[model samples]
Target: MTASPTLFTRIIAREIPSDIVYEDENYIAIRDIAPKAPVHLLVIPKNVSARLDEITDAEEMGRLWLTAVKVARQHAADYRLLINSGEKGGQVVFHTHIHILAGWENGPDSDT
Candidate 1:
């Protein structure tokens, strides 16, 4: 059976273009094609792991998490990070990725 297209795979293959801000051997930081916040970027790993829970290797998971932190700092000094796991968790793309959102306030009166 054909597999679903992963977010990382689409970025790597250039099937879907992104506003790439940073890139390295291990990861790539790009602006979200559909941004929810004023400043939204997607930090994706080079490795093709489908979801966060699917990653069994501790070292690999650690590396990806670290990469997310690094990318987040670069984009926003104070950013909100999110990683949706499954459908229940709002994981639209099967591929594991960290969403860095900032440049917006989320106070009590702030609109979500």
Candidate 2:
């Protein structure tokens, strides 16, 4: 049988070392190692699920999305939320995650 992919799996397997900010039974919040903004962070669900569309149930989706928002607010007074889907959408990791970017104004020339 194929194995289910989880956000924590990569971290646990040491495939990637995230600047972890928070962790618990259900979720993990980590700083974006290659950040685009000053306060770029990623909030990931601990459970195994490949992508946002792969989420089989509604409750799980709610929990994951809400957790991302909560963690983002903790770091900045205000922030922008993002989630990349397929490869074309710029999702590098197979695991599902929400990116919380803030602490800098996104001007037209701001690429980072």
Candidate 3:
């Protein structure tokens, strides 16, 4: 049986509305509905993975980080990249993604 579509996947299909920041063929970056920082964005891969650990391809992983970095640089001079691996690692959404937090005058605002 096919797994149900994830929230990110739904957003990718535009089924759910989101404040999209950046989007390309393989990734889409959107503003978090509940932002923890002054600037909080989630860079999600078009290809879905339940968790970061679930992805084993080196090139794919590198590309994901590259996409996140590209989006972060577009939004802020200074930013952070974060990934919550699994439920125990504080991941609420199963889709593998990188959080780009910025817009802080000082350094990182949260331990994350």
Candidate 4:
């Protein structure tokens, strides 16, 4: 883990305010500050991992996806789950997180 806390970590620590939708001991769900879809949420793990691929444990990976689904279902009937694996994969945060995109009327739009 980095010596300094990541943005998500600060939010989880309550050092930074966020629109948290759901939270548990190991995970947290929050609305994206800059939303792409009408209902854009982020499902993040409390434990720090630079990238999703960094987590190699089968159960841990499964639980992350499961928690993301739980959070998504709580907000929308249909949703898309996304994980940007690395900087080359379009991940900016450097923290492992799942993006929950949904709440579209006529499917997702480029501009929302």
TM-score per prediction, in order, is 0.84, 0.82, 0.94, 0.94
Report the lDDT tens digits of candidate 3 across residue range 1-112. Answer: 9889999999999999999999999999999999988889999999999999888999999999999999999998988899998899999989999999888776775454
- What is the C-alpha lDDT profile of model 2 across 1-112, one tens digit per residue? 9786454687845587778887778988888888888898888887766778999899999998888888987898878889998899998888888999888766424764
TM accuracy, model 3: 0.94
Which lDDT values do the candidates have, in the order given? 0.81, 0.81, 0.92, 0.93
- Ranked candidates, highest lDDT first: 4, 3, 2, 1
Which ten contiguous residues of candidate 4 have the minimum total lDDT? 103-112
Q: What lDDT is reached at residue 79 by model 4?
A: 92
Residue lDDT tens for model 1, 25-66: 878888887888888888888776777888899998888878
Model 4, 1-112: lDDT tens digits are 7367899999999999999999999999999999989999999999989898889999999999999999999999989999998888999998899999998887776443
Q: Where is the poorest 10-residue window by lDDT in model 1? A: 103-112
Worst 10 residues of 3 by lDDT: 103-112
lDDT of 4 at 12: 95
Ranking 1 against 4 by TM-score, winner: 4
Per-residue lDDT value at 48 in model 1 = 69
> What's the number of clashes in each of the models?
0, 1, 0, 0
